[model samples]
Target: MMRWRSRSVSFFALVILVGGCTAAHSGEPSSEQPAAADVVKVSTPDTSPRPNDPGLDAKLAPVVSSAVALAEIPAAVVFVVTPSGSWAEAYGTRAFAGTDPVTVDDRFRVGSVTKTMVATVVLQLVEQGKLSLSDKVSKFYPEFPDGEEITIEQLLDMRSGLFSYTEDVSFNETLDDNPGYVWKPAELLAIATSHSPYFEPGNGFRYSNTNTVLVASIAQQVTGETLGDLLQERIFEPLGLHETSFPADGDHTMPVPSPRGYLYGTNVSALQTVQLPDAQLQAARTGALFPHDVTELDPSWIWAAGGVISTAADLATYARALVDGHLLTHEIDRLRIESLGQLDETNPATIRYGLGWMSFGPMIGHDGAIPGFQTFMGREPASGTTIVVFCTMRDSPTGVRPANEIAKNVFRALHEN
Candidate 1:
């Protein structure tokens, strides 16, 4: 749900991707990766979604279509639910280079939205007394820099001060050169730990993939299980989210019926204007700033962070669940708000980041981007309203992210009407 912050790059590393990496890691999936259509299928998308709801789609489609045009992206599949009703719709082509149309049921990578799911699993573990949020990283991986000073809570909240390895220009360059490379979690951690921390643990806020990677590793250490298994058992099955699946470890394989993912970075002129964090990264970025077809890269790089593929309906269901505290006890769910920070201080209502999710005013969810796709979701608990958006291509002509921009239109359309 990092879209509350960086909808374009997945999270802090978007600016670091060679052609935009997986929101999961600085965005490396195997170039030899398998597409969902080639893998074991997710439960078939329920055929029940009607073509459109007159009251809902009639009003929302024009706004969305306008956005598709203005954003200069292709193929959007969106789902929105309001007090009035719910609707799912699609527009544009499945591939940036083809005529295959997209549908509401076509799957897209949910990206960092996986973090919300991972957080739910972590909280579930806490509820079961398997672990505690106050537990220190030293309790599991003491080798991590500042392991003793950083707590599980800080990792969950991105206050661990660990560098995000995905931001390493070298990492992104390597990722760009070899999207098929099967990256190990240890290797990624080594890259992150090689640098100094942004600040003392809990002293400042900066999103980093290292925190989540460490969190996932710690969870595995505690349970002796893959994060996918934990999520499948405790979250997906119970929630009846049949369309979701974490890509296999050290690989990228989404469920069947997924659209081809793409990366849009041909705007080298626009990219040159961006002030990247590291000079090395800027150089690497300069070398690979072009449109790319990343539909087949290994997804291991984004594991536990952003490498999730799901449909619009499934995302809406998950979004509502997260907002309503479906998987957690009421008291424990309240902890998600214990330490909150504004994603943008000037527009406080836009988003609030806490734990592993982002709150957009009353709506809750995240946004993600990979080379071939971008995703955004938001749910408003008060009215049972949820907005989910998917696009085959990421970003827009003016640099406005289509995923978040479409959701903004949906939210505004509902409230203004």
Candidate 2:
């Protein structure tokens, strides 16, 4: 699980800082050349262009293109849907060393954005009377510390105080040393349980991946079905999100036409800090150094928490549908929306975590990060405006989330225009 810092200012204020900057014009498409023997070259750009808004494109294209170049990201895809129209565009190459351009259709891991889907299933179970928001976690995992006091809603909202397993040194070391290892849910839970809670239940808001894994486990125990099956039945199939999938634990390969995911440093290094040393950062910025291709690394370590794969189009569709109440009853959707509370009381407008998702200003949905991939999907319910961004590189050399940063800029563009 990618644990992001919660110290940033409100999205609107931060957007103002980057929105006025002019687009950087580096990293133009190079002449096609033969790919290295080991590199997987994706030649087909099969995505048909969605309805274009020339004015919207003029505002968005420069923002995303500039961000990709400045961040040294291998590739990125951005999709925006507004009342006026929709625009979808891709930027950069499929591989850092190759010439093939990425397409809007290319799939990549959506990471913690999977939490929204898992949370949706939990909410559905509640609506069906199979579970309740007030249900105690101890009902499912009797031995978990303070489980008796933790409610299902607390777990969904990150108020359970459960320690994130991804924060465990051993777990991250394993990820660095054995990228191919397939992690079991129980194993992940065990790592989390071995540690003490960050705080008593509901005392503080901590974004712990353990809370989500526990929720998924409880949901599985209640329905006697795997989470993937539940999502496919309840959310994906009904919404026709054909491009999204919760992959099996053993499957590490990304779908065809997908760009290989890249990362600047090892998991342990990222755990310490996503920022590279100054010299290395400059080298990366100038294209003298490239990120490591970790596209084949197993994602099971973050299953239920961050293991879903999807494309730009699918994410935009899901984001809009989720905000529009396509996956839940009208009453339940209203409750879910109202469940939001300030993630940081000191900075109320920064971001709010609700039942199973988060809100950035008026945009309701979630962002995700895993090794080699970063994604953001959010839709403002009032205007039916959706923004989806996918970046092949997990973060810029300075530790900025490329997808989230680009989405914020895009939002600012819309606001300004």
Residue 157 in model 1: lDDT: 87
Residue 331 displacement in candidate 2 (angstroms): 1.9
Candidate 1 worst ten-residue window by lDDT: 1-10
Model 2 per-residue lDDT at 35: 27
- The lDDT of model 1 is 0.69
lDDT (C-alpha, whole model) for all candidates: 0.69, 0.79
Clash count for candidate 1 is 22
Q: Give the Cα-based TM-score of candidate 1 against the true structure.
A: 0.81
- Could you tell me how far off, in angstroms, the CA of residue 64 lies in candidate 2 after the best superposition? 2.4
- Estimated TM-score for each candidate: 0.81, 0.86
CA deviation > 4 Å runs, candidate 1:
1-48, 266-290, 341-349
Stretches off by above 4 angstroms in model 2 are: 1-51, 341-349
> What RMSD, rounded to one decimal, does every model reach?
9.8, 14.0
Q: Per-residue CA lDDT of candidate 2, range 1-417, in tens?
A: 112133122342233223311011112222332123211122221233476789888887887677767766888998898878888988888988789999988998999999999999899888878899999976765545566789999999999888899999999999989999987766776677667678888899999998898788787666656677667767776667778888875889888879988999889888889999999998987788888889988988998999999988878778867888867778999899888643332221368889989988888889999999999998887778888899998888888998888888788778773
Q: What lDDT score goes with residue 194 in model 2?
A: 65
